[model samples]
Target: MSARSVEVRLVKSGRTKIRYGAELLADDGVRLTVRAPWAGEGGRDFGFVRFEPGDVFTEHYWRDRWYSVKEVRTGDGMLKGWYCDVNRPVAFSGGELTAEDLDLDLWVSHDGATVLRLDEDEFAASGLAERDPEAAEQAVQALDELELMARLGKLTDLLA
Candidate 1:
């Protein structure tokens, strides 16, 4: 099938955090994959990694899963790492894909030597536990699952 353009919206607290265009790569009822270039204004340096203009991201989202995984690569196609987001299940409609950020994330270095869990403080302060305990639990579980996958060298399995 021919690839189609799609707009991806990452939402936080009922607001759109980021929206960018991507090329739809595949969809199998439950999951959707898209490839997009770095959408940031300039470059973001996180000490562990840097996201610049030529970076490319192949992102995977699931309708039933509580997280999304993105494979990050350099302009020359060298793998940088995997960035995983703990989010609500994704929805695709009207040529847009939307997912709500749950404030938890995991990052695995390309060589699998570095695994970091991020945004725990933000999640704890988000009041999600008080507002929706079930979702908060699921989000924590999802982050744990992703970390395990990264440690076991099985993170790529999700892409397949």
Candidate 2:
């Protein structure tokens, strides 16, 4: 293997088993490597990516973030995740992100989702204006972490 490449091992047998090298098929029928950089190395916390039932996974992180997609009772669909990479924006092909230009701005096309960046002032002035000051006020406070993520670049791209 190359210096940056690692071999993935198929621990369990199911639909996502592999007969070849370390590569294996995932429950979603997508082939993924168990050897992500986050999987620990040499007994140290290099990094680890482990997948399990219901489309869930336990992935360790290094310099980057981790995410997964799962299909449960309703059938496995893509899952989203975000960690320490808060400084950067996100994108998604599941939402068909945006235009494809020659620029380095590749946040779009990430799951084909369009995202609007909201400044702090804009967010303060934004939201529905209603007569019920309490309700409006509550709405503003209700803007939890998820809502804040929407205001960033493109968050939809972190799909499983």
Candidate 3:
């Protein structure tokens, strides 16, 4: 409604497992912005990077099938690059909202130049194709669309 505090969960598809959680900062029904502590954990090995526990992230989530974009910033408000997760449409229920991280990701640089795609191999190895081919195909399409948006620099407005 009016940017009330809510719990946001990133849950695995068709399961009760929660991969991540954050505090919802704003919600206009169609889109939600959330803030959470930045844990320097990702699928890839990018060496050592320093992020304080209270380093805030403002993540934007759409009700549609677009990927969620997280604008990372330091605790003192320094800019960090965006980390986006390609996933299915978000679902909100009760006091919580959830999204399925499709295992495909796109990282856009702070200046929005260097867009890197991540976790294709992990997506392929996730057995989603064997479990649910149609959903897996949709995930691929979502990834393609998000990649194009990142390349065209259309994702910057999403954070604002």
Top model number, lDDT: 1
User: How does residue 156 of candidate 3 score in lDDT?
Assistant: 78
In the range 15-120, model 3's lDDT, one tens digit per residue, is 7555445677777888888777764463333432345566678888888764788887777888767788877788887767788888888777777777888889
Between candidates 1 and 3, the TM-score winner: 1
Ranking by lDDT: 1, 3, 2
Cα error of candidate 1 at position 152, Å: 0.7
TM-score of 2: 0.18
Task: Judging by TM-score, tell me the better candidate of 1 and 2.
Answer: 1
lDDT of 2 by residue, 1-69 (tens): 433333432221123222222212222222232222232223322132223333332221111212121
Instruction: Assess every candidate by TM-score.
Output: 0.98, 0.18, 0.81
C-alpha RMSD values across all candidates: 1.6, 17.7, 3.4
Pairs that clash in candidate 3: none
Q: Show where candidate 3 strays beyond 4 Å.
A: 1-3, 13-21, 39-52
Off by over 4 Å in 2: 1-74, 80-128, 148-160
Residue 141: error of model 2 in Å?
A: 1.9
